[model samples]
Target: MKSIFFILIFTFSLNIFSQDQVLDITLKTLDGETTNLKEVTEKNSLVVVSLWATWCVPCKNELDAINDVYDDWKEETNVELIAVSVDDSRTVNRVKPLVNGKAWDYTILLDTNNDLKRALNTAIVPYTLILKDGEIVFRHTGYTPGSEDAIYEELKKHL
Candidate 1:
């Protein structure tokens, strides 16, 4: 049990230490504007792209968890959180009201077709990738009480 736990910790740390995979993927915003992924990450100290959905329980939970400490993350480190909603056409319309009601302090973007999701190779909601200098340094899927703290540490590495 101890060995497995240590291995898990080691592997997760390795994921954090890995170099960023340069990917050029464009996505459309909810308002119908196009955005290039590279354009957002390039020349930035830290850019976090999160793939989430309005109908996903864990997705909402992770966003809510992050929202709880987003301000603190900003104050401590100028980490920019770009939340890309993967909600399909059916649930897409609900995003705005949901975000407004939650008062999340992160930027909300839409990916209705899941192009960005496939381009990023993640099939799950709450998929988070952290980039520094336009290079992916850390990535995590799902959330727990102390996971945000771990992500904050990753952002600090590039700051």
Candidate 2:
């Protein structure tokens, strides 16, 4: 009975702790404003948070592909994409110019210190996750040519 009770309590504690692990991290905007991920998730019903770096080509491609059809996705599902750049201090300067050049319509957040990256336990660039009501519904890493279709299909399922 004692062993069983301890197991149950441990599982229950994990359930509560996992929810805030990612959302509690602080993120910065392009203009140098700070905000919590929890606040952003609370306002939007569905949010797509992609962790990318300025120097990663695959990350840029993934964001560009999504940007092409982003408007349609928003209209159909009312989903918002928050592109979180994991660029470190030395290379962070390139983010703004690249974003302007591509004109991506995303809520760009900077993680210059990699705090959010560490919180998410992400190992690579182009990490993407879909959150609904602050809970992660789907998560995928890496990108392929037609991955956007799959992403849209996943978003549709959550709706």
Candidate 3:
């Protein structure tokens, strides 16, 4: 009974730690400048973090959809979007070219080591979450057509 009690305590402690670990990750810009995710979130009232990959079609579609109305989003809600590429070493080279070609307006960051993905305990592309004052307020994975509308609604709720 004592051992079981200790195990339960340890599990509860780990859950608390993971809850705060999301924003503490360190990521780099495509230009190789290192920045902490928490610092980035602190600079914005609301931040939308999209964990994507170069090869994921749904990810690209979601970002492209968001980019179309991003300016309005910024103007209305002052929300900032950060697109974090979860590409590994083999396909990481495609990220810069793809971003350039798409001309996306969001801040792009590199997660070459998948540190953020592992930290978030997510295994899928197109994972999106909203952070308010550096704390995660919402999380969603996968995407469908017109899903950006849903995301926008969620942002408004937090604002």
Candidate 4:
């Protein structure tokens, strides 16, 4: 069933170990600056790559949850959260205003072609991958309340 596939593969519990699969992902930031996943990891000890859409309620919720603690998280871990909006061309227009309106401090990027999503092997909104030392350390999707705690805990370990 579709639900089964999502639960099994889309859930955050799934762990991806292959470095080649997640690295070499180059995407344009919302500001039109080109960046690679590994580059961000190099800049920081840890990097959180979140694939989301402006229209996804759960995706919005996850950002909202992190906006509260992100500043402190930065202070402690020097971790950077790159929020990639997977909004297709149709809805991409609103990504900026929505993010600006929400006041989320995470770095925003645009993946209109979904290059990163395809590389990561999951297209579902709200997919999150944590990269440490240029390797994916953890991955999760479809967040529930308090999932941020689990991610923060993992980040703590990597830091």
lDDT of 1 by residue, 54-98 (tens): 888887888888888898888888888988898888988999889
lDDT of 4 by residue, 51-143 (tens): 899899999999899889999889998889989888989998899889889989888888888987777767687998888877777988888
The order of the candidates by TM-score, greatest first, is: 3, 2, 4, 1
Per-model TM-score, in order, reads 0.80, 0.86, 0.87, 0.84
Clashing pairs in 3: none
Residue lDDT tens for model 2, 1-159: 999999889867654554432468888889999998889878888889999998898999999999999999999999999999999999988999999999999999999999877667566889898998888878788988998899999999999
Better of 2 and 3 by TM-score: 3
Residue-level lDDT of model 3, residues 1-159, one tens digit each, is: 999999889867754665543557898898889998888778897999999999999999999999999999999899999999999999989999999999999999989999998888677899999988788888888999999999999999988
Q: Which model scores highest in TM-score? A: 3
Q: Tell me the TM-score of model 4.
A: 0.84
Identify the candidate with maximal lDDT. Answer: 3
**Candidate 1 lDDT (Cα, 0 to 1):** 0.79
When sorted by lDDT, best at the front, the candidate numbers are 3, 2, 4, 1
Name every residue pair that clashes in candidate 1.
Answer: 20-136
Q: Which stretches of candidate 4 lie over 4 Å from their true place?
A: 1-22
